[model samples]
Target: MLNIVLYEPEIPANTGNIGRTCVATNTRLHLIEPLGFRLDEKSLKRAGMDYWKDLNVQTYIDYNDFLERNPGAKIYMATTKAQKVYTEVEYEPDCYIMFGKESAGIPEEILVHHKDTCVRIPMMGEIRSLNLGNSVAVVLYEALRQNEFAGMNLEGHLHELNWE
Candidate 1:
């Protein structure tokens, strides 16, 4: 399944929403700290609601730890500076779709290090970027669509609806 990684995410609500997305899609959510808000913050818990317990979420202390643990996993940095469109890439089953904080995109060093894997969502006019939560959902669903929405076996999991 596709993995969602948020690097230094700022908003609790965005993280909460992404947690819900991960739960609904059966994807893994990996967060690289330090985060702006606590996971147990009222806003986050509220936005995530009951789905927080349903989400398969993981936390990493830093990027180096994530890299060391998941070697060879394709790390695609979503940025406005990239030349390739995200949809053009062949989405891998264990790929890491990484996003940065809401106010700024990923660091230049990481972008340059993973230049070939960098991708961007096309935009028009003066729009710089999409909301953090929305961007994760868009990229995640696209990858899931490419993979035919695997592991989404909702048939026997009727009890999930009662989660949130």
Candidate 2:
């Protein structure tokens, strides 16, 4: 099971979108506090729609609290400052992929210590970063793909017709 952590997320809509993605992918969503918007914000509910209730989500007081609760967890910090591309690492089944707030992103203090696990998505000239929700999807999907999408359905069929 993969985990998606949003560190100090400021945008309600982005959090909602991330929540929906997490549900679809059977991943857990963790939110680190100092949030800019309330969890009950209308925009979040609207973006998440009916999926919000089913989301496997949790809240943490801070980074320290998260680390204490999830000991020995292999976490991959997603940041533009990372030296390696996100695809370079061979993600494990239970790895945690954390994205920073839309504004400043994860503090350099944290990234400095976790240099080995830091990763970034490739971007073209002048673009500072990708949208928070989009970035999560990009990295999460890659990890899922590498794991052969375990325990996930790989095909679909029409209700009234057969492939034969």
Candidate 3:
């Protein structure tokens, strides 16, 4: 299964939305430390609604801890500065897609270490960046597509849809 890592997320709603995506896609959600909002924030709860309980969310003290715990996994750093396009990379099931903070993005030190795997989503018309939640969704969908949309089944649970 794929892993979605967010480095120092600043918004509860974005994190919560990403959690929902992870739950639907059966991907593991890894959160790096120093989040702007608490896990129990109202905006997060509202955005994710009840699906938050079913989400497989993991927390890490920092990037180093995440690296230490999951060594050898290919980390694809998604950034605006990347020369390679996001779709060009051969994403693997063991790969982890890392997104930077909403305010400043991934630090240069970390970006430099994983320069070869760095990639950016395509944008046009002077758009500087995309919303964190939207960017996560886009990349997660792409990864899911590459993996044949694993764990997308919810056929019997249609009535349980939160529909937020």
Most lDDT-accurate candidate: 2
Question: Tens-digit lDDT track for model 3 on 65-134?
Answer: 9999998989999999899988888889879999999999999999999999999999997887999989
TM-scores across all candidates? 0.90, 0.95, 0.90
Query: 23 in model 3: Cα distance from truth in Å?
Result: 0.7
- For each of the candidates, give the backbone clash count: 0, 0, 0
Q: Model 1, 62-154: lDDT tens per residue?
A: 889888878888899999999899898988888899999899979998899988989899989889899999899888988998998886763
Clashing pairs in 1: none
Best prediction by TM-score: 2
lDDT for 140 (candidate 2): 99
In candidate 2, how many Å is residue 85 off? 0.8
In lDDT terms, how accurate is model 1? 0.89
What is the lDDT of every predicted structure here? 0.89, 0.95, 0.90
* Candidate 2 Cα outliers beyond 4 Å, as residue runs: 158-164
- Off-target runs (Cα >4 Å) in candidate 3 are 154-164
At residue 150, give the lDDT of candidate 3.
64
Candidate 1 residue spans exceeding 4 A from truth: 153-164
